[model samples]
Target chain A: MTMRSNRIGLLTALLLASTGMPAYAGEQAVIIDNFAFQPAQLTVDAGTTVVWTNRDDIPHTVASGDSTLRSPPLDTGDVFRFAFTQKGTYRYFCTLHPHMQGTVIVR
Target chain B: MLDVSEGRRDALKCMLWGGAGVLWTVAGGVPKSRVLAPAMADETGDGNFSFVQISDSHIGFAKSPNMDTPGTLRAAMDQVRRVRDSARLLIHTGDVSHLSHDAQFDTAAQIIGEAGLETHYVPGEHDVLVDDGKNFFARFASGAPHGGWYSFDHRGVHFIALNNVQNLKAGGLGNLGAEQLEWLERDLRGRSASTPIVVLAHVPLWTVSQEWGWGTADASLALTYLRRFGSVTVLNGHIHQVMQKVEGSVAFHTARSTAFPQPAPGAAASPGPIKDVPAGKLRSLLGVTAVRRVQASTRLAIIDTPLGG
Candidate 1:
């Protein structure tokens, strides 16, 4: 019975590892549209991955406030993902169009 | 028509005569010889290689600061001609019109042409409003493939006109785009690094302020190409203010507007007309810069003189 239980535990661990699941399964998404960012502000836990999808026809990008973090320009159907490792309110915007703005709050 | 008394008529005539005499005195009397002599001296000094920088003309504007839009533009043109020296070039830095209207462009062209000099232009955000810069490209795309960015050699100095307002960002630095970046890289490939490069564009390459719409999108990429050149002078005109920055081998300068002046960054509620000044002081608020490359070194001395100075 102990041998059978150990096999079952190993199988469960392997399954979890293969799935690539985060510890808390925390992730978020934001959309860019019509010269503006939908849900312009978001709050997520530390280590959460935030994905920005460009729904507008034109190109856009997410650049950090101090201009440190920059995503490649995203056309329609393009997406950019950034993992929030630090805890702070980070404001970003489309470098191609300055009026479009969004914020990612990691805590 | 004869409602007034003879005495009142006589007084009015006397007043008119007195006013005409004062006007004559102001125009043609006294030591007016001194003013004319100095003007002649200025003309002599201006005979050298000089150019006029008219930035952010913003024609077709219907604001209170200048309701008669064309009139104010004509006033600016008068100022241009008053100080314009023979054999000078006219460099317009962008925003020649407000809405990219054909009529506005025509008017601007007429007024600028009246200065009677070779005019070079770069498009502004207002100029690229229609057809993905079709109008602006059609009008000012000399030797440039894309939205009117090109380089030319003139009088031992290199002049590069770049377009940055087409694909712009809100509060971000201007961009030269990838294609233009590639072209710029290739264009500068054969040129010597010691060439004095004067880069003119619509938006400032340097970061003026991120909160307000005073910066460009991807200016760093273009700057990377420019870093190889010695004495790189980057001139832009979006902010409509006189701001200068010098960063190790590059000097960035922005000229004042030929139209109305916007408020200083972070000073007003938003970027618009800054009121509360006396009426006669309006012209002093706006002006241009005269840049001259001194001999021997790659250094340029710029004089920012206010309008009617």
Candidate 2:
């Protein structure tokens, strides 16, 4: 009876460990190049991570319309990541080239 | 001596003379020159007129595309002279020089003077580089506001020259501060709503993308004052490209640079001199627009012409 009780306790602990796993633990990479953002429009779940990688030699930045959520100017091979906790559409562009535009949709 | 005819004969003669005098009076009422003048003037009158709009001359720039900046400016001047009529006036929107250098100003003045028309200038970012725009103020202070915004009447049209480069915020949009706004309100108070209003500034009034610093910080305020005018034309230069927007009664136009062409808003990796084009194509890349105003009417017809053409 004691052996059977210990077996049951160990089984329950293993189930909880797998079921309570955290979401979005890894970073999602976005590549910027040729004056455009790859996957110009991105859709991600809430609490997901988004990363921007500058593939071009020139400098670029990601600035929102309201001047909120500004990423530091990224040089070649530099990366910037932001984790989305809320659901909304965020539009951004490279400050160096006001025309280089992209949109990230957080679901 | 008054001639009196014999009773009946004198009376008849007087009546005939009176009738002939009335006929002569009627004929003489219309001048002989009036009959011939319209026909004579019609043959020689082409009735075509044009003016010059030069922006972003950037004379002191030492970049590769336009190392000898004055040379390109001279080219623009040549284009102006070749197209300009005798009645043309030169209107420089802003950025007359790149570095606000004394020699640059001097050279620019000499080159522009060659056009032989009275030149009007508004200050640009580069022009106000020294001491909150002291250098530009010293030279162009007359008839301008504290920051170099001014208005004048020419050929029955009202031209308001604004200084947007001074005290400009991060984005390139122009600002008409409180004092200037008050002055503008008063200056435009007495004018009729039908008056053709032309507002010239260095930066674009409309939002031309804020990320790249291509738009004005406080343009909506100034635009509110201009909305009452019927034919409002806003001309600007800073982004170094020809982009036009017509909103309600106002038409906003941005002229290209006489120096070098920056890349299209989002076409390049970043905004800078686009060196990919051939050297000879540079002149073709930049051009001017000729604005013609109709007499006794507020209508304006604009024709965009390339430099070589």
Candidate 3:
């Protein structure tokens, strides 16, 4: 099953690349470390699911502006996944520490 | 570093943090600090009334430096019980639960309720996250003015409970939303400037560290209203450490956590718990702050008492 999914993800990436779109894997991971989002800014293709894994000792959340995403309190080692099916820019922040923010440009 | 008595060790630890044994007194709009031992400091001061401030219990947290959060809170409660005869009431600054879980709130209520004293609470960002404070307000705050913010009078002192954690804006610090600010303006209206005002919230009203998100965003306007008071004591938590600031007659203080200790401002990369606390040294890092004022005393003394020493 893993091999099958990998092939399908690669095929989808190829199709998006042929259309002159940002080629991104179907799944992307963002690390929450040091009370900040590692990338802080990300560019992902449509239909890509973004996963945020909390690596810091404290808890955080990935909450979006237009309600595109909302994660429960994520403790250390916990993960919150959201699929960005629409093509738009998404802004999110950790409600617990709102100073920590990020932007996702979905193409 | 060497074999020393627990009391002396605590004194050393307190010296490093600049917290314990320092009695704060505000006279004629000027603040003064004098060192005193915690044991001697607890004596029924010449003040007419005294209350307790407990904060950042962070129940349901099981991690380094402190494995059992509830256990530390219980121990801290024991210290409070010891002074039940002298301490008139209890004020918890916030963070009653780590994840705002139902069982976590239940455990906190069960333990704090044992004090058998009326406890007033404000919502921490953590407590309001799970259900927008549905669980927190239901259990700890009912009929609270302006949604988990209210004001009460005790011993001729006016206590204002402000909730700066709710509706926090993105890329901003803790916020007392616009509606709540409007309510606060109305609440303070008609009160004389001589009223001793005590403001309680989870986040420090003063900017302790902007990078760490340890302050409230709209606190400047709130302070504008409070600065006129003769004696204004602003007690806050969520930093998990003791910090103080005095501007004129208004004194701002942040209490230590009962669960675990976080690094001082800018001391660590993040404001997370200090995991490497030396073995047998955790209790000294955790403490409860007492707010007391003697008869005819013009200042409110906030003393931090460690659970162990």
The residue pairs in collision within model 2 are B173-B215, B173-B216
What DockQ class does candidate 3 belong to? Answer: medium
> Candidate 1 on B191-301: residue-level lDDT in tens?
887776778898888777676657766778888888877667677887766666666667676766655555666666545544344434542432122223222232434
Whole-model lDDT values for every prediction = 0.63, 0.61, 0.75
Please tell me which model should have the higher lDDT, number 1 or number 3: 3
Worst-scoring 10-residue span by lDDT in model 2 chain B: B17-26
Candidate 2 lDDT for residue B241: 66
- Looking at model 3 chain B, report the run of 10 residues with the lowest lDDT sum: B14-23
Which residues of candidate 1, in runs, are more than 4 Å off?
A1-97, A100-107, B1-47, B169-171, B279-309
True contacts kept of each: 0.27, 0.10, 0.75
Q: How displaced is residue B207 in candidate 3, in Å?
A: 0.3
lDDT of 1 at A21: 43
For A1-107, candidate 2 gives per-residue lDDT tens digits of: 99999898777767755875333445667898866788888987677788999886444667686766678657668898888777899888764455577888886
Per residue, candidate 1 scores C-alpha lDDT tens digits across A1-107 of: 99999998788778866875433436788988756777899988778988889876445678875865678657567899888887899988765457667888876
Question: Model 1 residue B185 lDDT?
Answer: 83
Which candidate ranks first by TM-score, i.e. highest? 3
Residue A51 of model 1 has an lDDT of 87
lDDT of 1 at B139: 76
For model 2, residues B14-117, the per-residue Cα lDDT tens digits are: 21111110000001111000111101222212343334577787777654454555665665565555444533567777877766678878888888788787
Best by lDDT: 3
